[model samples]
Target chain A: MTNVKVTPLTDLHRASGAKMVEFAGYLMPVSYGSILAEHRAVREQVGIFDVSHMGEFVIRGKGARRLVNDIITNDCSRLAEGALQYSVMCREDGTVVDDLLVYVVRDDQVLLVVNASNIEKDLEHVLTFDRNGADVENVSDECALLAVQGPRCRDVLTSCPLFDDVREQVERTAYYHGFSFTHGGSEILVSRTGYTGELGFEILVPSNLAVEFWEAITQAGRDYGLVPVGLGARDTLRFEASFCLFGHELNDDTSPLEVGLGWVVKLNKERFRGIETLRQEKKNGPKRALVGFELEGRNIARQGYTVLKDGVEIGKVTSGAFSPTMKKSLCMALIERSAKGTEGVYEIAIRGKTATARLTPLPFYRSRAK
Target chain B: MSFENMRFSKEHEWVQFEEGSNLVTTGITDYASGELGDIVYIEFPEVGQELKSMEPMGTIEAVKTVADIYAPLSGVVREVNTVLNDDPGIVNQSPYGEGWFVKIEMSDRSELDGLMEKHEYDRMVGKG
Candidate 1:
């Protein structure tokens, strides 16, 4: 077996009898009790996920915003301080390097969060593109993140005493914005942003204090039915939100345009990596567009399953599951833009058998705001 | 039938032959259900279908993964769990009781020789 890494909360997850799986080199929990229950906890009440495996980088110095904007496809120039912008970095070929969140710290500073597996490559890419030699520090090993998500997330967090002194600030942090608090003499950052469509917060803490925060918050949310969710529920929640997960809807071969992320690409701004190519793809439209589908019955089409039209290969499923919320076997497939004329129905090959699937919107479920 | 007399397959299925009879009832083992997580769907072989030894008989769909339920021995399916159609979570809740997937009539009495007893199956699954 490959020697896998473990996050700060690995021991705690093990103590909770979580099913651990190797994900991005870290031994992360796939589920604690049931993925379905964990999924419902996030949708109906609140749930927490130890997303410490994600990578973090701090960029500072003059022109940092401009330089960061020059690297990511999204427009960061108009981004206000204390706000986070959904962004992606692209290679020169217009294919995605990684989809990330750019926390605009200030005019001369920003923090970038990337997929855990792409830390080295993303760091190298940013450093290579740093013409001014702006300070870009990788803090992936030192940081831990917990995603507290759902409609009751606001209440759960506001009730937690971890940062009670800044309770008002925590409660008032606007969507996509964050506030810093003092925890054990170290700066802790919590942002009102998450992959789940629910009103949620992503708390970033020092690696040493991850467990403390986990315990404190889980205790505070006991009445709210907060549970320690694993990566399995995290995926289902994000999938229902139609969030683009790297290595699924995005990769080195897939452009933002193909994944319905054109909204994040600021083509009007000054030249950035892949600008010309992405602009060209935007004008002509991507060859394929990501779409969601449901198999006619109970069968599921997992990642890389073929999507066919008229007995011919058309596309492939990127991510799929028996969605807990939707109560159906649904999947997101990147089909040829021409597959639209297939009359809303396509076939998925599951275990060598052809199952009929019909096109649906990207998100199979949306949280009904209460 | 109690779980004490059950035989297990390497694929994580449990079979218990009725006392002094050809009929045997089968279901996924507890270890199988634990590994599969919450079961969302189960596809059962039709009643009266011939099931060859160690061959694909049906499928078990969990929230995260899907695996084919294989026959542990040569047999003919006499009954398939119809309750799984409306409430599949029973497979995870009661893998040895209400969750039994199929009842089969043994085609060859000696086919059970290849199966593992509880201790052996537990050892194979690394629990014993």
Candidate 2:
């Protein structure tokens, strides 16, 4: 068996009695106590997630902004300093390489955080740009990342004296925005961004200080209902929010336009790598549209299962699970727009038997706004 | 609990033989359910279907993974817990009571001899 690489916090996860599993080439915590408990903890209070496996790259030098703007589908020029924008890094065919967050730290420096599995490919793609204008460095190994997510996250984090002044700053920062702060005498970057559709922050710190930082936050947030969450609940939470995972919802073959992420793509901007093909796909409409569905029966639809209409196979489920929050089996399917009839009845082939399913609107569950 | 009266299988299934009717009620053990968290779906075999000992009879889909439910004795399925259609979480909540997967009419009474008792099954699972 191939050995999965452990994060710098693996020992801490094990000491906390986390159930470790291989996910995206990293041996990460799947749960600490229970999946449902962790799921609820993040929804109701605050949860700390060891997301250090995510890849981070630093792009610096003159003309760095131009190089970044040329590669990603989103218009980065509109982003002010100290802001973050969600965009899809795509190939020339308009197929997504990965959906990533771009942090424009300064005029000459930008930080791109990508999915763990696509790090090598993303770096390779970024390096293909003319090296004479910009320098790209993969700094994923040097940094550790943690997400303090939920409604109570701000209260839990602001207790740290180092973040006292910055807490006020983060309060004013809107969603998808972030700023830098000093914590424990260490300068760290805190972003008001997360995959779980809740008010949260993603903190980037040095790898050596990760365990100390994690313990400090967990201890301070204990009375406030903060729990250390694992990857299991993280997956379910993101699925409920209809966020795209790299291999499941978004892949090298799936375009942003096909998955209802067209808003992130900037076609009006002068020219990017995938602009022409994306423009054509947008005008003609994608052949297959990714849609959310709720199974009527108890059977859970899984990946690669055929989605049938009137007993004829029309499409296939890409990502599916039992939504812990909604108490319903939910799935995302890529189906031919023609076969997506207005009728609510659809069948999912599960173990050779067809189970009834219905096309629900995207986001099977929504959080109560704070 | 009468330990000698109940028989178990290596797959963590348990069966209690009814004295005169020659029928048996089968369910996965508590240990099995603890390992498979929050069963969301259960596909049970239809009534009247014959099953061989140690053979795959049904499938249980949990929140995280899927496991096969195996038959503990050679028998024909007499009844299934139809309530599982709406409340599959019963498997996680009570694996031995309302979560019983099936009732079977025994094809051979001697099949029980091949299975383990509670003590042996517990020993095999490292809990004895």
Candidate 3:
């Protein structure tokens, strides 16, 4: 509990009866009530989450695009101003440093949103390319983020009076795009992006105005069934969508190619970190492949649970949960690629006993997000 | 089933003994259920199985974590609440009523003497 950071919305979350927990050095809300209900709120209607704990770094200078392009796996040079690209930064050996969002703000400025836990490590990693002449600054503490997500997300946002000045821009923003607008003399950045498999917008406001913005959005969204969500439902929502969580699916030693995120690795582009290794991996295939599965019954295959084939261990579960939307126990595991076969049954060792599981497609739930 | 006649164990389980018989019903406390969040499944011990005082009897699986349930006293499992198999959330809703875990036919009724009464258990859990 000592040295744990609190976001500006901490008091508000406490007032709403949130169950707070320490995650990645921050005392954040895991849930306000039942995670199932909050999960349903996002899938069926709309929900808002205080995701301010995530790290935000701003890179600026004439060498900004080059420095960013030289570090991440994805091609950011093709991005138009105001566009966002999902990418991963890798070590020299093609293993992940972190997965992040690259926001192209201007020709000379870029914003990188990364996992909260890797702030210091990521900052250090980025500073390695300082000789490229780009100025790297960690702006995580100065920013507060809110993810307004669901099928009805746009409707609730448009109806909020606080966003009256920016309603038009918010409505016209395309998926994976963002725009900066002034609301009541305060700068706000709105992006049509989210980790949840739902139509959503992630709004960024100054930390000092976080409480004001949250209350305003909540007040306007009350009639639209907008519930205040927490990290618990955030994980479940992302898990159901088969999105890769950094610690779970994309650790430092895990290659992007092995985790089904190969699309972000543009080996054909100019040289970047791990280009040689990733190109070799792409040609010869990775040693391991990430896959999803469904347990036969109520049995849950928790993280680090061994995945076996005929009593021999082949892999381990990276993430598992009783899917609130699917009502079935689901898991994502990284196993030896040679052992993969969609038709075969695998056993997941849970608390000494094993549960039978069947291999399924990567994304267990398809999003209704346009 | 009244609180006055019930005794609690340190493991957050409550047990109520029948006045004239050795039959005792046991389940987790409200605080335990609340802390566990949403209980999705429960692995109950089989009927007729003997258990020693404070021995592991079963496990409760919630969304976030799993917890082991211990036998409050020496007994033989007589019955289990099958309703939990279909809707484990009942444990979160009514932890002491229909959500009862097992009915044990006690072998040593005097073991209950070491258990805490309602007030003491409440104080131990910070309610009192």
Identify the leading candidate in terms of lDDT: 3
Model 1 over residues A96-161: C-alpha lDDT tens digits?
A: 999999998677778999999899999999987755857888999998999999889888888888
lDDT of 1 by residue, B1-128 (tens): 45577888999999998668999999999999998999998888889899998899989888888999999888899998899988899988999999999999998978777888989988998999
DockQ of model 1 vs. true complex: 0.84
Candidate 3 residue lDDT tens string, A1-370: 7899999999999988999999999999999988888899999999999999999999999999889999899999989999999999998999999999999988899999999999999999988874477889899999899999998888888898878877898789999999987765777888999989999999999999899889998988898999999998999999999999998988989999999998999989978989999999889999999999899888778889999987789999999998888889999999999889865669999998999999999899996555
**Model-by-model DockQ, in order:** 0.84, 0.55, 0.63
Tell me the TM-score of model 1: 0.97
lDDT to native, each model: 0.88, 0.86, 0.92
lDDT of 2 by residue, B10-114 (tens): 998999886787789998988888788667788899999999989999998887887888999888999999998788878778887898899999999998999
Model 1 interface CAPRI class: high
Model 2 misplacement above 4 A? A1-3, A160-162, A367-370, B1-5, B17-23, B45-52, B76-90, B93-100, B103-105, B118-128
- In model 1, how large is the Cα lDDT of residue A172? 79
Pull out the clashing pairs in model 1. Answer: none
TM-score of 2: 0.91
> Which candidate should be chosen as best, given DockQ against the real structure?
1
Worst 10 residues of 3 chain A by lDDT: A126-135
Per-chain TM-score of candidate 3, chain B:
0.97
Off by over 4 Å in 1: A1-3, A131-133, A342-345, A367-370
lDDT of 2 by residue, A1-370 (tens): 3977888899999998888888878999998867887888888898999999999998898887888888899989978888888899888899998999999888888899999999999999988777557889898988899999998988888885546677787677777777886656676888888888778889899787788888888888988899999998898888888888888888899999988899899999998888999999989988888898888866678888999988888888988888877888889998887777677568899887888887889877774422
